[model samples]
Target: HISALKKGRFWITPDPYHKDDNIQIGREVKISCQVEAIPSEELTFSWFKNGRPLRSSERMVITQTDPDVSPGTTNLDIIDLKFTDFGTYTCVASLKGGGISDISIDVNISSSTVPPNLTVPQEKSPLVTREGDTIELQCQVTGKPKPIILWSRADKEVAMPDGAMQTESYDGILRIVNVSREMTGTYRCQTSQYNGFNVKPRDALVQLIVQYPPAVEPTFLEIRQGQGRSITMSCRVLRAYPTRVLTYEWRLGGKLLRTGQFDVQDSTEYTVSSLSRDSYGVYNCNIINEAGAGRCSFLVT
Candidate 1:
């Protein structure tokens, strides 16, 4: 009787094992456990986490094998391994003869994908202006890792002077100091990122044309009486780029006078005819060019 009891009884009741030793986060893995017992007609299985009983609603599933042939094989599936599931797992089995067994398994999860992408946006080219005039140059870029931007002039990099350059990280804006003629040249914007394996390089070129205001203000501001009873005012603009457009206006007592004798010529010369005492208080010539506007005023007696 003692020999038969020993041969029919199984010592180990549960054996647990993990599908893989290492797994990445956000992936699926399986955990299996087996139990061997005599007279498996009344056998119960339970799973636990870190020595604590696990609930069925804890995203864990258990399946029982054939009870008549191999009642010891039970499988537990844990889908979608997460960082929080990196602890130990245990399986418990119970039989009718007060037989019980438990087994433990461990799981580890990690990351296995590359980083995010980085992008840079198009920037507006710098504008050209004359010396002593306020000039602003701006560049904008965008990226996931937040790319670093640099500004250069004439192939030489420029640094922010004392309270000269201002930067807005949220808006990705870069501003330069007061611009001068020496500051005019080919400006380039370079962007780079160190988070990726290869450094991403992007650049944009802008040409700055420094133009001076209409040089040599128009001269020859004179009023003369003609042979007939007509007054003529002649003005000439000397050495003006873009062939400045000239305009002549006559004022009396600080009030503009209406005259049908106003003339404007593209030959850098302006003349007005049929002028009388009413159009002889003050005469002024206005010269304009792409750079800026200039004026010359003279009093007529």
Candidate 2:
């Protein structure tokens, strides 16, 4: 005859990541729970916040180390500390074998009221890109009361990703799709309120450079010049990237008049000395860059 086995003893302890660290806004807080069980492999952990079940998210992370590495240890990491984060967190450890009772432990995390501080990553700012590309301008904020983030242009109103023309955005991230030259400028990230401790560092700046193909002004120009007189035909190249390695061409009567390359020039000009009747016809100025080409016509009468 064999006797039945007695139930095993189990308990849970609240663990703190560090004793010297204080709860503060914009700081990471981690609460750990350690469980003592007969068969640690059969242990399962669940986390809760303010009586509601909690899962891993961008700001909240739940992790449990392997039983071999750190047996029966689980961690709850809260990032970018906020006022609402001050609450009771419970960790429940259960056994799959069902021989022992479940163990539950609660840990309260609190923080002193703090003001908002905003900062943009240095490497992420001063964004440079060509046309037709999507970009994101991210600004991070930390405060006890969860400050609201707004994005806007320093010069004018902002155009959000949703096609809504607003002065500011509350989404924190300013996403611009199919970027164009018009969208190039200084953008300001501002917060709604201060954290009340005179923590007034509430704004940041981001520079955006949108480069595109050459754009020519006055697509068509008409001029009157008599025979035997000299004339100059020119076209202005609008703000374009890659100012170097630009190729310019002059055409007349379906024939190429002159071609040359330029390093830096706002406009390209073609001169005709002692103009003949053939030169009085239409003259075309074509400019080509890595982005694209721009063409303009001059009607020399």
Candidate 3:
């Protein structure tokens, strides 16, 4: 069994009951062993207990991978530890063509282990920040065999700083630079075993809010109405940071005709009592918030 280091290799297990080789009976233990080797795809793994070759059973399993966690890594999982399970377990790795000497690790399991636990900072969700700012999302993970940390987007794929789009990241802290509106959403931090264990991993979530200027559009670009008929002109704010229109300015041609405050809605409407010669012109509605201002205009006849 590998020792639990705060920062080091990957080890995954579900509700591990011991730390290192000291495991309690009637519990589960997963030993993740990795070796440095080339042509990892051609490497195979074998397990032996007390010098006897071991095989997979209902309570025991062995798995090997080339690129999952690293190049040459394997996992030996023994469940429901009992007195009979106490012994020196050895893992042997050998290349298919027998190019290099076989590498092995011996783990003495007497019987106890700690399971992994994951948590996030309180009230850290809905993290509000402006665009172009850098942000870091973190998670607190603790376990006997410290689990691997994986960062991921709860709803979409994450964009890494290196321009690679991936569903998950191995780094413990997720740093996003020059943030954009597309980065707004929920981010999930979870305990990962990479490719080692097949048990359910613990997870937590935090949200990111990217604030920016508002974008607006006119409900009607152009309208034609007969004289003596009333008409309503409306402007819709497409998107904004503050999300509230503090001030609204209605201008006829180049002069401001009316001004008011709208605190409840993003959309505002102006009603022209009667369509007359003086009312027939280009009317503009400008909406202002703390972040920025946006305007929408329409022509009337």
Candidate 4:
């Protein structure tokens, strides 16, 4: 209360409680305001809790009982004390001619109720996407005092493919732009802080899966000046979900190359030594993976 309130001078104080003043969690608490001012008819009352206006509902009721009383009066009844209900309550009385008076009181609740029941409704949804696609993983948390949500990803893979980026919103929303094959991993959303309360800290997880096609452009080993030296060529894919299981085949023109004319290296590379006139045509590499197959060709002279 400020001294300037003396002009209209309506003091606001918590009246005696029906029970004890010590309010417990999950229990109802009632407080009455005794207002003393110059004129009772012009006095208008409004209530606030923690700087926010308080409204009447099933959980709370605020109204004037008697208008003829010398000092205006307003009653506040809280049905149940939630964790968020433990805050300062204020009552302000204003007169028609710009005169104002206000007072605030604290409502302390017991910490033994429940430790914020937090849950994510959409945690079971799959966050799967194809390569070069936009992806969003949504998580909704419900709790009293509103739990703070934060998102984190496991370091298993990093998809900087073509400058892809990711972002998380205040409401536990994760967005990835230009999703790529290397972005697959596990992501989690959990609560951070809740004042000094002993919260149980809840969390949810989602699996991210990225799928892509095989690389269509394979590097070729440049053929040096003619010789009996061997020339090596490769057909490979940089990214695949089950990456190690790729199949590669080397073809000359439209027909498969003979094993005696070229040597196969792992699953992607092929070498053609002892240059014969038959190797002077176009050489094609066919690479196959779980997602799809791709091919690239190079003219050997």
Candidate 5:
């Protein structure tokens, strides 16, 4: 007799990524948050400071690690700590099935006027693109002393799989040419306080959502999951971008598989919840995103 299969869940690691520091205003600061979940790719992150949502800009920044890795991680950074930067910072990790977890810290930021005021123009909402298209993200940094501009990804490991692509303009604009689906992730606009003692450290963030209409149909393959006893039929749709906006549903031998038709793991990759000889059949995976709709069928037997 075979034991029953288990479902996935979400959780987080305890923190004080680093103890909060009491620093003078001209200085910079950093904080990190770590979270883990089975099939971690489904976890979405949101950061907060002093009870408010924090967005990337000259004064604030956030980034994440590849979820496919163990104990996926996220970060919170205050580029050039300002008087207004002092407060409690929080990191919230959420799952679509409804579970949520978070961690918080109190950062005692001291005051200083030596560092000039650092500010960045508002970041536009994320843009949609097809494979092989070029995208440009622009930001303007304004301050008393002209500051140096820099660019980085919120999730470097996942976004820049091919290493650094040097397309930065002298101004605060970043451009990508002949882009691939994997190049999608949040990009940051940052500035340097070259005024010797400095005035302030500032940064900003923008999101790039990539959408690839199915390059190839979905295919089924057997994968190892348990102690050599359990296995799954994996349905993968290649080159799907902006995966967060895509919807997935399953079918067997041309018949629609409802939510309760059987236990299943729904994601960019569809996995049959239970495995048995009886589970073999022609499987169809359906995906829909702004780019368009895609469907694929494969025999598991």
Candidate 6:
């Protein structure tokens, strides 16, 4: 003879898991619940938020462990979380054997009240600039509650100079006196704001480039004569910026010769080797800079 097995409903104790402290915004977190019921038959689990039933969707899922092997364990998973999902979560499980289990989860989602905004003037150019040249740049940004602005160049923070002679118009403006090429480099601006327990820092970068006229003077001038008395005069230019195309004009008694009479090389140096009697007389060189032009005359006997 065989004895009949007893079947009865079993209760699963509530198991809740959540963070005790508040979490920061843009952070990922997990909330879990574990419960069990004896003789699990036709087990069904439902999740709720603050007494409201949670609708089944791709964002939420409920699964139960194998009833024949690991009876009475259910899990609820939420993925790709967001700030709006923060609230109370309740897990309720029902079994056909008249058993039930309840679990509660308290979720605290961090909130950020301030937005990030930062701006830098001349964000595309180098820092150090040439003196006597106008520098144009801009800095403007938008954010919640605004943000404090700070500027720096070449790792050094820029601030208003302290002195009675310092003019008020220089505030918030980056200026360099007699700027040289050595002053060139990176420039950065940072903005930050604090809202309640949240703090955010944003930054903007700019390259400050200084432009100025050339400084170095022209080098030696020499005359090179090719085969068949084809004469070519050349001048060497040194340390010149904003390179210009050079032009050569041959003169007989100060009268300009025709272009067909001689050939002139492009700027950096002027050369006219194809010399005839028309290419000889008195010659003069004209050099132009960003500021103005200078003229030097040489006599060709």
TM-score for all models, in order of appearance? 0.37, 0.45, 0.53, 0.46, 0.36, 0.35
Steric clashes per prediction: 0, 0, 10, 0, 9, 15
lDDT of 3 by residue, 243-284 (tens): 754677999989988888877776788899888888898998
How many angstroms is residue 78 displaced in model 6 relative to the true structure, after the best TM-score fit?
A: 33
Q: Model 6: residues >4 Å from true position, as ranges? A: 1-116, 120-131, 144-148, 154-179, 192-200, 219-233, 244-284, 287-301
Clashing residue pairs, backbone N/CA/C < 3 A, model 1: none
RMSD of 4: 13.3
Mind giving the per-residue lDDT tens digits that candidate 4 earns over 122-173? Answer: 5445566777888877677553334345566645444333333333345666
Ranking by TM-score: 3, 4, 2, 1, 5, 6
lDDT for model 1 comes to: 0.47
List the global CA lDDT of all models: 0.47, 0.71, 0.71, 0.58, 0.54, 0.44
Task: In model 4, state the lDDT of residue 201.
Answer: 50
What candidate 3 gets wrong by more than 4 Å, as runs, is 1-9, 12-28, 34-38, 41-113, 156-171, 195-198, 216-236, 248-260, 263-287, 293-301
Model 1 ranges off by over 4 Å: 1-136, 154-172, 176-186, 192-200, 207-279, 288-292
Could you tell me the lDDT of residue 53 within candidate 5? 90
lDDT tens string, model 1, 78-179? 566667775656666666455344323322112432222323333345465665666445545543333445555544555433333323222334444555
Task: Return the number of clashes found in candidate 6.
Answer: 15
Per-residue lDDT over 1-301 for candidate 6, one digit per residue giving the tens place of the 0 to 100 score: 2211122111111112333223433333333333444444555566777678877567755566566654554544555456676666665655554534333433322343234455554443444345455554334555433434445553454432232222221122444455554444565555522211123346566666554443323332344444346544443334433345333333445565432211343333335555665555556544544543334454444
Candidate 5 backbone collisions, by pair: 56-205, 57-203, 57-204, 58-202, 58-203, 80-201, 115-199, 116-199, 210-242
User: What are the RMSD figures for all models against the true structure?
Assistant: 23.5, 15.1, 9.1, 13.3, 23.5, 21.2
What root-mean-square deviation over C-alphas does model 2 reach?
15.1
Error of 5 at 154 (Å): 2.4
Candidate 2 local Cα displacement, residue 231, angstroms: 6.1
Provide the global lDDT of candidate 5 against the true structure.
0.54
Better of 3 and 5 by lDDT: 3
